[model samples]
Every structure is written in structure tokens, then in C-alpha cells.
Target: MRTALNLRLFLAAVIATAVALVATAVVLNFLFRLYFEDRLRDELETYLIQLSGNVAVTDSGEVEVGPLADPRFNNPLSGYYWQIEVAGADPVLSPSFWGAPMALERPEQPGVIRVQDINIGTEEPLAVAHWVILTGQDAAQRSLHLAVALDRTDLDVSVAGFRLNSTLWLAVLGAFLLIASAVQIRLGLRPLEKVRSEVNRVSRSPAGRLSDDYPTEVLPLVEEVNQLLDTNAATLERVRAGAGNLAHGLKTPLTILHGVERKLRKAGQDLLADELQTEIASIEHIVERELARHRDSGQSRQVCEVAPVVRRLSDALSQQPGSEQIRWSVEVDERLRAPFDEFDLTELVGNLLDNAMKWTDGRIVVRGALSGTVASLTVCDDGPGLSDAGHEIVLGRGRKADPERSGTGLGLSIADEMAQAHGCALTLDRSDMGGLSVMLAWEQAEAAPR
Candidate 1:
């Protein structure tokens, strides 16, 4: 449903060019027909002048026509003919006429020549020039009608050939115009393409900004976009500062409550102390989850190698108390890179590995690979995995599959939130290692030197 600007412009240019060429062809055809017909009429008039000069009247009153030089006039039905008529005498005809006179309307006045189209029993019409002349003096004076004609089919054939040639050339011109229009549209829109690339660069890096080296027409848009990026960057800094202040303000009270819970336990008030502990833990989980979300929200997306982060997390976790007895299998390509903030990737992978270290049965597998533009990171363990329904429940805050586990159930929830923030999908499935498999996949960014 979305139309491209280049396509729209090209289509408009095509329609306009087609219309102009068609109109030109029509006008040219009409003008050429008139021109060719005018030339034919002039030729006929020339013949009529020659015939007038050669005409004579004898004393006995018989009309005589001297021989003319044109050979076409001597051939019968040759589409050329001449005729001379004297009052009260038989008409003088050319050999081409075959004794058939053209039905021509004579000029009303002597010495006046008129030209018109007339049919003379031929397939095509004839262009005839007729002249009425007075010969002799006094009582011997007589009116002479002189006429000459040529077949209209000759003129029609010439015009038709002109039309064909003109149309072919016009079509060639139209094609050239269309190609030129397409190139113009592409060159004209190149600035917008540059703007899009610059915008993408800004999104992928915290400090990237649009440059001013652009055309005059596109400069204003570039300036506005750079200003907007500056504004958003300022706003994000303020939001991060606010989140930090909120965390500090809330943490102090939670710390004091922890001390108070210890006092109540020393006084043997076990029930009240337990209740306070539960509330304190709940508040702590909420604070941590919210703080993580805030951090992820302000993080700029960039490409980072997946193997280094995975291996670093694995090494750090391996030194932990329980993980010392477990085997960590890391199989990630060094070149596999995805659009993710380093801190976000660390937090997400760290949580998944920590969770696996908790329930994993002495063996864990971490794998990262790139498939086309998508990069996938999978962390699997030999620990007992969750059922299909429990998969969804564990992703909720504070909801652990086994309530008896000695930790707050915020790990998977925070990892899931971070994955979603980075436009990645976190899925839980049964691992081949007989435990939970947490896979995070996202579209990879353009390749960059590490």
C-alpha cells in the first residue's frame, strides 16, 4: 500500500512525456498533410498555366491544344491529365484522360484559376485546377475552359509515409526522455538516502550526528534532525539521573529495615521478623527490576562480539562456590555480533548463567552463532527443566518454579525484560543436556571491525 517517491515521480514523468509526444505527432501529421496537398495543388496549377499558353482557336471555330512536354500526360490513366474546352466546339483532351472528362466546376470569371478535388472514375480522387480564359476579339471572341488534374492517392501515400517515420522517431524520443527522467529522479533523491543512513548511524552510536555537507534543499531537514537528536540525548541523561536518585533514596530505608528485622529476631519475635523479611525482600526485588529496566531503556544499541561476553561470564561464574564442580562448555563464534548494549548483554547473559549454575546438574552449555542477519545465543544446562506451563510462570517477577530455592526469583524475569528491550526474543525450551535452555535471538547489526 505504500508508494515510493521515485516510482511516483517516474510515473508522472512518463505520462507527461507520452502526452506531449502524442500531441506533437498529431500536429505534425496534420501540418504535413496540408503541406503535401498544397504542393500537389501548385503542381496542378503549373500544368493549367502550360495548357493555357498552348491553347488556340482556328477561324473555322475548332479548338486546338499544342503538345506539352510531360510524359505522364501521354500515358492513359496515369493519374495526370489536361483538358481544354472552347465554346461550341469539341474539348481537347490529354492521352492520359482516355477521353473521359473530369467533372470540374469552372472558374466563374475569365483569367481566374480555381483548384478543388474531383472524382473521374478512378480509385482515388483528383486535385484539379481549372481556369476560364477569353480568346479572340470582337464577334470572334470566345471563352476557353482550361483544366489540369493529378491523382490524390499520390499525395495520400506521401503523407502516410511521413506519419510512419514521424511516429517512429517520436517513440524513440519518448524512450530517451523516460530514461532521463528516471536518472533525474534518482539523483534528485540521493540526499534523502544519505539522511537515512546518517539517522541509522546516530541510532547505533551514542555520539553520531548528521553532517551539514548536503544540498541547499535538504540542509534544513538535516539541521532539524540533528537538533532533535540533541534534545533526546539531553532528555535521556536527565531520566537516567532521576532513576539513580530514586534508587539511592529507596535503598537507605531498605537497609535500615534489614537492621530492624535483625533486632526483632534477637528479641524472639520470629513471626513479625519473618513478615518484615518477606516485605523487605519483595521491595528489594522490585527496586532491582525497575533499576535494570531503566538502565536498559537508556542504553544505546551497538554491535558487540558475542563470544567474549559469553566466555567472560562463564569464567566469572566458574569461580563461584557451586560452579567449581560444574563443567562450562562455551561454543561461540568470535565474529558473531548483534545489536546490543554491552551492559545489557552482560546483565542478560549473567542472569541466565547464574540461574543455570543454581539448578544445573554439573554441566552447562553456552553457544552463540550467526544465521544470516540474525544472531542467536543459547544457554543450556543439565538441571531439571520447567514444564511447558511453568516456562511462562517463571518469567514473571518473584515467581520461581521451585519455591524452596534459596534466592528471589527475579533472575529470569530481568533477563527476559532486557532481551525484550533489545528487540530480542527469549525462549525457554528443553535442552539436549536434560535441563532448561534459554535462547536469545536478535537481528545482527552491520559488520564492523572489532
Candidate 2:
């Protein structure tokens, strides 16, 4: 199967955009988590400073702490706590711990806060910020350790919320990007589509060429295509000219051979003359077939009314010597058209009519009709019809139903070649008139004017 450029480009864009958005979401979530954790540690440090300021050492080496302002420190297992420790004295703890003391170590430097994560007998961990300070006068001074801790679950909840919201918004953004990418791809490929249309126009036109109204990126392609078309037209012209010249060159010799054959027959050399005549007829058939092929190849596709061509050929053929006794019938609509050059259509119809005139006992029929976009032309006669096998045999070059018939045996072959050249189908079948029926059908290029 052929891959479409639009589909391939859209798929690539979809993959790239999806990958980029996922990476963005991951990175943003990671960075946000770190920032949220940092902010949480700063808040814990602030609480630690408040707790240290509330601590004091007694003259008898006893530790004392004032009630902290935050209510979470007073509630049992509230995931928030404060503790104060003095050397040679019992530590003062926040009621929020519920008698579960945290094994926090003292900070190395006094008055410097240090933060760490520790499990607090709960499903989530705690973020602890601790500091050491000196309390009391010089002789009575005591090193006191102050600490404030908050549950890690709070940070987890905040980060989780941010991640959810960010993902939702980012997904929406990715959707927009995908739609925009699809539109961009379609717009970007429009010029190529136009080029294809112009090429089709050229094929259907006699002297058509591609236009210069294209993007700079596609201009070179357009120029190359135009050059190729010019080269092809030139090549076909040369081929037709050569074929015509060769035909003219051989005509005189064939004519001379005919004269020689007649003289040999008059001299009673019947066998030798007959062989020469056969050779000459074979050469003539080859020349005629090649000429017809060359002519059909050079012609451009066109929409020509089928009725007029059939009528004209029928009128001319009906006036021939043998067609006088035959009853002619033409059933064709005036609007019926086929995708074929007028010259080629004339030659094709002429061959069928001429062949019918040769074999018809008394009646011949020609039909032309348009059904939807397809147009058909059929010529039938009332004569001895061939069997199904003979239908295929007569379509071959130099093949005829009767060898004794005075013809080059190329009429049906040439007609079939013309039909195929225009992408048409030509078939032979048993006619209702008791003879061969040759039908040519092709898709019409455009509707003919009423």
C-alpha cells in the first residue's frame, strides 16, 4: 500500500509532541517537588527559632519551655511538634508527640539550623529542623537543643495536587498542539496537491504546462516537471515524424512490389507472385499498426461527443458500395461523451463501422450512450457471428475470421489499441443482430454542454 504524506507527517508530529509533553510533565513534577520540600524546611526552621527563644535554664540546672503559639504542637499526634533539651536536665516536649520522643541529634554548630527526614511512628515521615543554643549567664549557661518537625504527608499532598493539575492542563495543551500540527501539515502539503492537479491538467490538455505560482521550496520541483513534460512532448513529436517519414519511404517500394507481383502473375508465375503478395501484405499491416500506435500515443486525453463521431462515420460508411442493401440503425444521445481525442475516436469508430459493413448480411446497428461517468459505443451487424473463442482471436494483429477476406487484418487491432491508449476497454461479443458486436467503453472526462 502507498503511504500518504499527510498521514505520515501527522503521525510523526503526534509522536514528537506526545514525547515532549510527557517529558515536560515529568521534569516539572520533579522540580516542583524539590521546591515544595525546600519551602517546607524553611517553615520548620522558623518554628525551631520560635521554640528556642521560648527555652530557658534554671539556676538549679533545670530546663523550662514556654507554650508555643501553634495549636498543632498541643494536639496529640498532630504530625507537628517542638522539643527543647538542656544538658543535665530533662527535655521539654510538645504534647503533640503523645509521649513518643523523637531521637533527633543536636546540630553541630549552635544557632545553625539543620534539617533531616525521620520516621515518627506513622505511615508518613517527618521533616525535622533542629538547632542548638546557649541558655543562661556564663557560669550557669547550658547547651539546649531545639527542634521543630512537620509531617512529610503535607508536602506529599501539595506536590500531588500540583502534579494532577499540571498534568490535566498539559494534556489539554498537547491536544491543541496536535490539532495545530495537523493543520500545519495539511497547509504545508497543499502545494504538492496543487502540483498533482496541474500535472493532471497537463495530461488532459494539448498544450498545457505547470504554473509558476508555487512556494520557493517547491519551485524547483515544478521547474523539473515542466522540463520533463517538454522533453516528453519533443520526444513524441520526433517519434511521430520518424514513423511518418518511414511510412512514406516504404510506400513507394510496396507499390513497386505490387506492380512486380502483377507482372509475375501475367507471366504465369502464380506461386512466386502469391508469396510476394503475402509478404507485402504483412509489411503493410505492420506499418499501419505501428502508425496507429504512434498517433494514439501522441494524442492528449479529451472529452469528445460520441454521437457526432458515430453519426459521421455511419453516414460515410452507409454510402459505401456494399452498405446500400444494409439497414443502418444509430441509437446515440447527443450529450454522450467519452475521454478520447476526436481524431482517435474517429479512427476507432471508423474501423468498427468499416468492419461491420464488410460482414453484415443486411442490417447494422451503432449505439452510443452515457451512464453516469461512463460512455459506451457499440457496433453490431447481422451476419455469421463468431464463437466466443473467435472474438479473442480476431482482436490479435493479422488475425481474421476468414483468411480469404481482402483486408490487412489490422482494423480490430488498431481499434483495440486506441481504446487501451485512452484507458478504455474494448470487447467483442455475440451481437443481438446475429453477428459480432464490438463495444468500446471509457470513463468520461467531463460532462458535455447540453
Candidate 3:
């Protein structure tokens, strides 16, 4: 649910650090308390031994204990309290003990010293322990226990005070850390923000470009986009210029020719009428050819399924003159597709098969193959195919092998040019159908936008 990228990462790190700090504090407090208790118990044991050494039995069966010369060691008000219990019929002890019973955990358990909570006096909460020892008086062995305690009320108050200040500091530090992290997030994303702004700027019109001012990571997309724009621009310019030149070249000549014809008619000369008609026919052919070229060039290459084109072209060829007389057949993998413009596809196949129908009387065959990023289209006919000279001339620009040949005759040349433009090639070979074979191969581009 947390949408900020840097904040999420920073918070995760901070939480982890806080958890580690709490764990460390707990471990250190445990160790520190343990060391402190051990030192306290050691002092208590030393005091018990000193008090026991002061005990005297003067061989009169009279027992006497401390009223020592060590003034510093005699104070019970030093937050150090003790209870020496000497086992006897009625052993008397210090009246300094006022309230709160010292709890000896696991009764009769004796050792160096240990810490425990005890009731020492009214409103008094003391951490206490006892040290037990044996005394030898002739044949009598007497047990004595020295109980020492400290008032923990003051220490608890100091610890609680320290905790209060630490909590406030932790809150201030956490706020400062969050603020710094937010600033860092903004700084880190600044470059991406600039890229977004530039993108917005470029989106206004077709003249836009991905700018060169970008991080290295974004350069490839910029370069590919620029290449596409440049290529499209060049193509558009070429098309515009070609259209203008074609209009001027064709329309002006036709207009002048019309004027000359008008003058001839006005002069009453029927002499060169047939020649004039032939010139008009020639002009019409040029006009139709260029028009077809313009239409075909505008047909962009696209990823088109090849089987359908083959079927369509084959069926059309079957309806052509002398086509049904020749058996027709098509073989193409149904899944195969090609990078082809619709007009080029028609022009390419139509030319090859039309030329084939010229002589093929038995059968015509069409095959479409897809292989390793390349599409190969084969069109073959069984008629008496092209002569070596005729075959070469058939595909040449505006050149018909026999001067007697008819038709606009730009089919093969146009197919070649279209193939080149689409990053494909054309090949000629002998068909197994016993005629000339023509193959068109091209690399198809993907339809998806990068």
C-alpha cells in the first residue's frame, strides 16, 4: 500500500535498524545487571567475613560480637543493611532491621552471595541476599547467616528518568531521518522527471523527436525513434516531389498536345489524324503506368498472411485468357505470412504468372515458404517458358524482349523495385513444372509498436 519507492526502502531499513538496537540494548542491560549484581554480592560477602571475625568467645561461655573500631564499616544507613542470625537458644541480633522480610529463595540454600527482593522496613524495597558460615566453639559447631541488602528505589528512579529523555530523542531523530529520506527520493527521481517533461513537450506534433539530452539508459529508444522519423520524413518528401514533377510533366504535355490538335483541326488537315491518335494512345499508356506506380508505391508493406494472397492471385490467374486451358495449382504453408504491400504482392505474383501463362499449357504452380526470418514465394508455370534472351529482357526496366510485345511491361521491373524496398530479393530458375521459375523472398517486420 505504500506507494513511495524510496520511502518504502528507507522505512524498511529503519525498522530493521530499530529492531537491532532494541535487541542490543536488551542484551547489554542483561549483562550489565549481571555484572553489577556480582560486584554487589562480593562486597556483601566481604562485609559478612569482617563482621564474623569480630565475634569473640572469652572461654567464660560468654559470646560477644561487633562494636568495631572501623567507623566507615559500622553504618547501616549507608543503604547497606545486614541481619546476622547466630543460632542459639535465643540469639539476639541488630535492632537496625525495622520492616520488610528478606526473602531467601530456596531456603537453606547458601553460597558466595545472590540477589533477591526483600522486606527491610516500611515503604522500603531492597535487593538483598545472605552469606552463611559455620563457627567452631570447642565441640559446638554453630551456623550463622549474614543478610545484606540495598534500597533499589533510587536506582529505579534514575533508570526511569534516563528512559524518558531517550524516548524524546528517538522521536526527534526518527522525524529527522524521515525528512532526509523524502528529500533523497525527490533528488534521485529528478532525472526521470526531466525525461517525462521532455516527452510531454515532444507529444504536441509530428515534428517532435526524442531529444539527445537523456541518460545513457534511455538512448536506444531515442535512436530508434529518430531513425523511424527520419526515414518517414525522407519518404514523404520524395513522394511529394515525385507527385509534383509527375503532374507537371504529364499534364503540360497533354495540354500542349491538345492545343496542337485543335490547331490541326482548325486548319482542316485530316492527313496525320491516325498518327495523332497513336501519340495520344502512347500518352495514355504512360499516364496509366505512372498512375499505377503512384498507387502501388503508396501501399505500405505489412505482415500479411501469404496463403490468402497466393489463393487470390492464383484464382485471378485462372480466369485470365488461356488460363483455364492450363491446369492451375498452389502449394503454401497455411501459417506462412510475409512482409508485403498489397499492390506489390499482386504485381509480383501477377507478373510472374502472367509471363508464365504466356507459354505454359499443362500446369502452373505457386508455393509460399516461411523459414528463419525469411519468406520465399515461388511461382512456376509448365508452358514453353521464356527463352534465355526473353527471360533476361522481361525483367529489365521498360524493355520487352520482342519489339512485338504488348502491355505496359513494367510488371517485372516494378516487382524488383518493390522487393528491394521491402528488404527482399527476386530470383529466376528452371521450374520442376518444366518452365521458368520466379521466386520472391523478403524479410517481414513485426506489426507491434516497440
Candidate 4:
């Protein structure tokens, strides 16, 4: 499914943050439990030492345990206890002793002790004993020792209270962090949101463009897009203005010619009337060609495929009159696609070829070849070539190079404008066919070539 860019970015940040937090919590929780358990073990081991110090052998050889001095150690219900004993007699238990004297299988060995949910009387479900035997003493006189059981019912209760309180506090912190993450995501993405809102108001119709000032990160993109829109708008506006101006400017002369033709018809001079009609038709043709010039002024410089346009033009030209009589050739690599519209590029090449065909009395050769950074086109005609003045006037507005040099006077001008729009130029010179060889030298950028 398609998602908003900002939303996806926000969600990705949230997920990554959450994963990091969970990983940290797990690691820290394990460490806390490990350290806390160690502390509890150390406290139990310290109690074992305190109890041992109170034990002594009497003169009659009976061992006696003195009353524990610490108030907490004396309380049976406090969940802590100890046992003192000398070998061979019933083990001495504290008055607080609430369990059976231990029957340890390993005889009070020292190290890790494992005992589970053993009952210690008074309805206690949890009790544990840490027993150790003092070595290097006589067999009859060795101290059989123990660090007595914790009520653990109370220890468990304390553990439950501690874990509950810690969890509640951690939950509150986690909630705050989640809310903060949402706010942070919204705050971080504000600039891009502003860009979207700005773009929403722009339109291509009235040549509208984006104008919002984005953050430094997005500013370049916004600026480039706006520039492209502006360039396209300017080009389209120029074409519209040029069309309006050309229509108004060329119509006046045609109107005058029409009036002159009417005058000649009313005067009834039949011989001269035919000549005037032909001249008027010729002028009308020129006016149409000038309109073509204005129409061809727009060149769209988006990604355009050159091969398709060439193929389309080749097909179109084949259908034209006397198309088979001339040798037509098109050469382009598969990657040499035109950057202009298929129709626009086609119209440019087609017009140039049509003009060449008109002037070529014999063989006409048209070919487009590319070499590295430059693409060149040659439309050679075995017909009368252009004179010195033809070069200047061909590119000038509405003026023919040679008044006597044939065809609708606007063809050369249309050809020149098309060439410039397509990023090429027309050069007038002699052909090997003893006619005009118009060499078009176009430099295609390593970037998109129009």
C-alpha cells in the first residue's frame, strides 16, 4: 500500500526507538536481578558468621549458644534464622526454630545450596538453609554449622512489593517516552509538511509555481522544481504571444493584397488578373508558413525518445509525394533518444527534409549521424545552392534571402527556427551533387540532448 512519506518516516523512527528501548530494559533488568541476588546472598553469609561467634564449649563439654544480641535476629517471624551445633548430639536450635533439623545429604558442605518450596511450619511455603561445616577441628569437637532458613514467605512478599513499585514507575516512564516520541516525530517532520501544503496550492493552469520557504534541507528541491515550472511557463507564454503578434502583423499585408485583387477584378483586365491571383495565392502561402514559424517556437525539454520520433517521421515521410525517388537515411544509436517531444522533433526533421526535396533537381541525401558529443545532419540537394545573402536573411524574421529564390518565402525561416529550438543550426554551402548542402551541426550535451 502507498503511504505518506512523512508518516512512513515517523513510523520507522518510532519502531527503531521502541526496539532500542526494549533491548536496553532487558539488559538492565537482568543486571539488576543479578546484583540484587548477590547482595541477598552476602547478607545471608554474614548472618552465618554472626551466629557462629556466639557459640562456645562449656567446662562440662556441653556446647551453649548465647542469646543473639541483634533485635532482628531474635525475631522468629522476621523471616531470618540460624542453628548452632557441636558434633554427636541433637542439633541446638534457636527458640525461634520452626523447622526440622536439616538432614543435608552432603553433610553441610559449603558452596551453592539448592532447596525448593520446603515447608518450615507456621504455614510457611518457602524456606532455605545455608549450611557449612568448619574444617580442621577434632572429629569429636568440630563445629557443625548452618545459616538458618529465611521465612521467604516474607522475602517473597518484599520482592513482590519491590517489583510492583519498580514496574509501576518504569511503566510511567515508558508511557511518557512513547508520548514524547509521537510529539518528536510530528515536530521533526514539520518542514516537509509545510512543503506539501505549499505544493497543494500551486497549479499548472495559470502557470502557478511553489513559493513556500522550506528548511535548508528541502530548499534546493523546491527551488529546482519551481525553476522548471517557471521556465515552462515562460516558454508557453512566449509561444502564445508570438502567435498573436504574427497573426496581427501578417494579416495587414494580406488584407492589402486582397484589396488590390478586388480592384484588378473590377477593372476587368483578364490577362493581368490571372497574374495577380497567382501572386495573392503565393502571399497567402507565405502567411501560413510564418504562422508555422510562430507555432514551432515551443520546445519541450523533457525526456523524449529519439528512435520512436525518427521511426514515426520515417513512416510519415514515406507516405509523402515522390518519397521513394529520394534516398532517405536515418542513423541513431539505441541510446540517442531525443529530449524534445516525438511530434515536435519529427516536425523539425520532416520540414527540413521536405524543403530539401523541393529544391533538389536530382539526387537528395538526408542522413543524421552522431559521433561522441556531437550529432550532425546533412540534407544535400542536387539543385541551385543558396547565395551569400541567403545565409543572413534565412534566419531574419519575415524576410527571404533572395526574392527570386523560389518557394513560399517562409520555409527557410521556419527551418531556421525549428533548428534553433531543437538545439541545432543550419549552414548553407555547396553539395557534392552540385546543389545546396545544408549541414546541421548540433552538439548534444552528455546530459539530456534536445
In order of appearance, the predictions have TM-scores of: 0.84, 0.87, 0.43, 0.49
Tens-digit lDDT track of model 4 for 171-190: 67767876787788788788
lDDT winner between 3 and 4, please give it.
Answer: 3
Q: How many backbone clashes does candidate 3 have?
A: 7
Cα error of candidate 1 at position 281, Å: 5.2
| Candidate no. 4 TM-score | 0.49
Candidate 1 lDDT, 231-346, residue by residue in tens = 97788678778878998998789889978988999999989998997888788778878877777665647656678889888888898775678998999977787567666778
Q: Which ten residues in a row have the lowest lDDT in candidate 2?
A: 296-305
* Model 2 alpha-carbon drift over 4 Å, by segment: 69-71, 75-78, 136-139, 298-304, 318-327, 333-339, 370-375, 383-393, 399-405, 420-423, 442-450
The residue ranges of model 1 lying beyond 4 angstroms of the native Cα positions read 69-71, 87-90, 211-213, 259-302, 315-328, 357-365, 371-374, 381-390, 401-407, 429-436, 443-450
Candidate 3 local lDDT, residue 326: 80
Alpha-carbon lDDT, every model:
0.85, 0.84, 0.64, 0.63
Task: List pairs with backbone clashes in candidate 3.
Answer: 99-120, 99-121, 100-119, 100-120, 101-119, 359-383, 360-383
lDDT of predicted model 3 = 0.64
Model 3, range 1-450, lDDT digits (tens) per residue? 557766676777578657755665566556655666667666656766666677654444345677634454345455656565655524334444444445454337554555577655476767776666666665766666666566677656655565565556666766777667667767766666776665554532335676787668766766776787678657856875786678678887777776776578678875675457457646655654565466445344444566777788778877877556787778887766565544456666777777777757678888876666666888887755667777677676656554444554566766766667556788777788677888988764332222
TM-score of 1: 0.84
Which 10-residue window of candidate 3 scores lowest in summed lDDT? 89-98
